[model samples]
Target: MKKSTLLIILLFITIYTYAQRDQTNQEPGSTAFWENLSKLCGKSFEGEMLNASEKDQFYGKKLVMHVRTCEDGKITIPFHVGDDHSRTWVLTMEEGGMIKLKHDHRHEDGSEDRITQYGGTSSNSGMSKIQFFPADQETTDLIPYAATNVWWITLDETSFTYNLRRINNDTAINVKFDLTKEVETPPTPWGWED
Candidate 1:
């Protein structure tokens, strides 16, 4: 009888531990959105330009984004456009349940770009699959003309979309990647140690 009781207790403890892990992994409230994004770590996806009306030359090439690093409070994705591997998008969970997005651009020699680290922070805890970042004070100071920029990211089972629009200027950029099919992981982004 005592053996059976101990066996039941062990089983209950195991189930309880798993439940706690699940809860922490898919926490409620603000962390829900971040947890969704964190699911893509160590994966690469191919993308295409969604807003072809703009006729931008840079984005017309083969585009790939690799979700390289993921931690408790941060995820780093490197965006590669053709042969240029200079841009990395960093998503960091900030205090007050806010999320911050920063673009780190570098040159072939691993030097920082003149306009690097330009991104914004979330104004609210967005939906589980989408988050919007309005231009923060840092972006306005980096490039005054981009003061009205608003960036948003959406993630679902089939696709992930990154979007940008200048509220006052009508400038827009939309890039969508296929989440259903992951491509081969690309090389390290600029400035990253091998």
Candidate 2:
């Protein structure tokens, strides 16, 4: 009995040592955030509208967000509302270690929508749990009305949030997804196969 107990203790010590080493070896800066987000791939979560504009009727129904694709330097998440699956949020690690967020909107015919691929890059090396993106010049050129838009995303043990606020206007949208609840994955977003 004593021999068995000693073997078990040794095994736990080995596991703990490796776990500590892995934590210490994690990449610095936003890499931690990227890694955290990547861990959610292949999972879907239900979300609630914290605050939305009156015209934002599209999000007033059952909402689900799935971490669909995750790659070396990019992750694409699909947001589905009711029967609409036209929106996907793409996060990419840009040059100089910055992060960029883009909205990929598409139609049912596998074509891009008129207001697609407009977002911004992170202005700082944000914490592993949160990041803020301000409108870029390209976004301003593409959507003149959203020249002063800012988007923020946050993730923690309990929930994840996607928030948007316009500096020029009083527009604000916040959607919170419960991380503890794993829901059924929704259908593919528009323009995506399978």
Instruction: List TM-score per model, in order.
Output: 0.83, 0.83
Candidate 2 shows a clash count of 0
Tens digits of per-residue lDDT for model 2 on 1-194? 99999999999999999999997787656777888899999999999988665578755699899999998899999999899899999999987668999999999887999888999999876779898899999899999988889999999888889999999677688899999999999988989976
Per-residue error at 92 for model 1, in Å? 0.4
Off by over 4 Å in 1: 1-29
Clash counts per candidate, in order, are 0, 0
* C-alpha lDDT values of all predictions: 0.88, 0.90
User: lDDT tens digits, residues 40-156, model 1?
Assistant: 889999999986753686555989999999987989999999989999999999998889999999999999999989999999877778889998899999999889899999888
> In candidate 1, how many clashes are counted?
0
Q: How far out, in Å, is residue 55 in model 1?
A: 3.1
**Per-residue lDDT value at 111 in model 2:** 98
